[model samples]
Target: MDNVSQITMFFLSGLNETNNHRFTLFFLTLLCYCVTLLVNISVIVTIIMDKNLHEPMYILLCTICMNGLYGTTGFYPKFLWDLLSPVHVISYSGCLVQALVMYSFACAELSILSVMAYDRYVAICRPLEYHSVMSKQRLIMLVCFSWITPFCINASNIFLTSRLKLCSQYLGRFFCVNWIIVKLACFPAQTTVNGIVADITVVIYTFHGIFIVLSYMYLIKTCANSIENRAKFMQTCVPHLTSLLTFLLTGLFSVLIMRFGSKDFPLTFKNFVSVECFVIPPLMNPLIYGFKLTRIRNRILVVLTFKTK
Candidate 1:
């Protein structure tokens, strides 16, 4: 307990073995972060600048792009700096904030996707009620719900983490996460509440997964009967599915690796799995929505052509 009180920062050992390849990794990471910014921003800017995209679906797409920016920003800048420096360390407070941002960003994403599923369900299943169901007031509320609920949930976890006496000042991953911090607690009893809250959080998101699955099941069944509905499904729902799959598969791997990863596994491989969620989704979700959606694609083309002239 005295040692924990004296601790001021954590040493991130994830990058210790990469010293031999630091410059190459730095260049690559810098490029990835820049491209992530460019693509996500382009999608967000296109949607915001073009008033024709003021519909519910486009607004949600914009929100997704904005979130990609939020999540990546929380990690990339610190990571890029660590790549350049000899030491990989973060202050206790900074680590907590990063954990909060990363987890909240993830949970908020699933929440937004759930909302998107509802949007599609209304659009396809109850066309007449789509407008009434997704009115401006309602959309605003849903957006708030998506971001806020996760923030509060993760905030509670982080608050619990803040109270613990951490026996270790080292984290395996390049970035901090609540679970890793919880695992460092000096006493097992200290983590009981943390574990309970985490389980509840998992249950909450599991139900979100169930809701999305049920929504899409109905969507697929309905679309099967009508050619027009099938076309709409291809145009809109496919991109959502791609985004959802990318987010879920990457997140699943991260969780599995954290919980069950063998010590014999190469650090590089484990690091890659842990960071893949941050890398892939931010870069791909915008591109998927930008090119896959007709309005966004055409608007981007028009701007590019106008610039060329």
Candidate 2:
């Protein structure tokens, strides 16, 4: 509580331990970012260019990849620069924007995953009504819901955060987070509205998670008794499940660390935990789908073969 004010800048303390091996870390991080872009873009382009991948499942996957790109672009560019710089500072406005992008990206991801679960449910559980249920108009609306709702929800949080008088300018994590910004507020009472809104947001997304779980549970029970549904689940739903679990695990780790992590933990470990959500899912989702989903995998392979020939 040393220099209370409306902070104009924030010093990021996550990279404090990177001085000894900054260049090496920078190289690895750059490589990771490039690979992430390559895989996500590859999946997105493959789906768009192929006529057969015009189904709701592939379209939803494409949406997920797009979100991956949107989220990672917010973090990686700033982080790579910070890795090489002597002073790691971000303008207060820039910090808020990054936080907005990060949280909205996460929430949007869960929303999209919920959509995917429903898509699979309709496909496997109600094959006769799949087309009418997941029509182009409906698909468009679902995608918009996935993206827009989270943006609006987090935007409200950021709006509330922007009004706070900060007691600190140092963010311990590598990237900006809304909760961290809220924690920096000069007065506890001023954050009452923020706390209420944040809790409501959590409950909303928690319900999304529950909906997904229930959908998949029914999917499993229905698929269990039928050989055709079992094959379909293996072919299509597995990748969705993989992506969901990856996202959930990484996101859960980040939340747990942020809420109850030990300060005695190494900065390196904390930094890794902070970025795991951004790094792993973006890179893994497309790869999981590309390798596991038959249509996408075949499309990618055919394209590669044609280019090589």
Candidate 3:
């Protein structure tokens, strides 16, 4: 047999159990993907067109929806195709690209959420200086940091994974993931650097999570002293908290599954766990923000009514 280094394609074994229901799954997945696009695009377009909604909060919400679209685009199309194809395979380069997109998308979400926390912190806890603190220039910089930092970090991780020679071409999951690819390294020693970098990436994002918590702690304490602040907290802060909890829980579950999931678990269950982050947050974030924010909700309703007429 030729060396595994010569292997240019990987077989995804995660779909093996679902062959009998491929068509049904394909329709359902396509429907979900369509809805994801519709909701995300609607929120994005509503924000873009409504000049009055161009404040920092709405802009950040728009960023979140844009990120939702960006992240889900990386997964849904390929997944829809794989659902119908008998051979679930991807080329080596394609696999790395997918890993880059998937990881960066997840990382960027946390980064953006951290920025949103800061935006909220300034708006509520220090209302007098909210505009100066979250100026247009600063918001642009923060958005760029959220997007670019994650891309670079994940790209580095994928580059390290790319240098290693593989001993296997069959990835058990439905999609390519950097950690899974790392597991296929020809030698255990080859992955020491990858593990170290992965740890650092984890630490960076872990601190992002910590910063969010502390920011909210201060937010809660500040809001406690006044009914006006309490009303503001319920109106603005709750949606961000909802989004943070949704993103964090779903992301954490996916990571846990990757790191500790049992092979004995049903493939169906494992597949759901792997994809819950992609599914829930993309679909829910826009809806949560849209209905929760009165301006967005009113504008969206106006747009819908205008369209209907």
Q: For candidate 1, give the lDDT of residue 295.
A: 91
List candidate 2 segments past 4 Å from native: 1-5
The Cα error of candidate 3 at residue 291, in Å, is: 0.8
Residue-level lDDT tens digits of model 1 in 1-309:
442435579999888889999999999999999999998888889989989999999999989888889999889999999999999999999999999999999999999999999999999989999999999999999999999999999999999888888888999888998898988988988789999999999999999988998999999999999999999999999999999999999999988887889999887679778978888999999989988999999999999999999
Model 3 Cα lDDT, one tens digit per residue, 18-70: 98998998999899889989999999999999899899999989998999888
Candidate 2 lDDT by residue in tens digits, 1-309: 333356789999988887899999999999999999999999999999988889899999999999999999999999999998999999999999999999999999999999999999999989999999999999999999999999999999999888888989998888899998999988889899999999999999999999999999999999999999999999999999999999999999988887888989897787789778989999999999999987888899998999999
> Global lDDT for candidate 1?
0.91
Residue 71 error for model 2, in Å? 0.8
Angstrom error of the Cα, residue 125, model 2: value is 0.8
**Model 3 superposed RMSD (Cα):** 1.9
Deviating ranges (above 4 Å) for candidate 3: 1-5
Clashing pairs for predicted structure model 2, backbone only: none
lDDT of 3: 0.91
Ranking under lDDT, best-scoring first? Answer: 2, 1, 3
Model 3: worst 10 consecutive residues (lDDT sum): 1-10
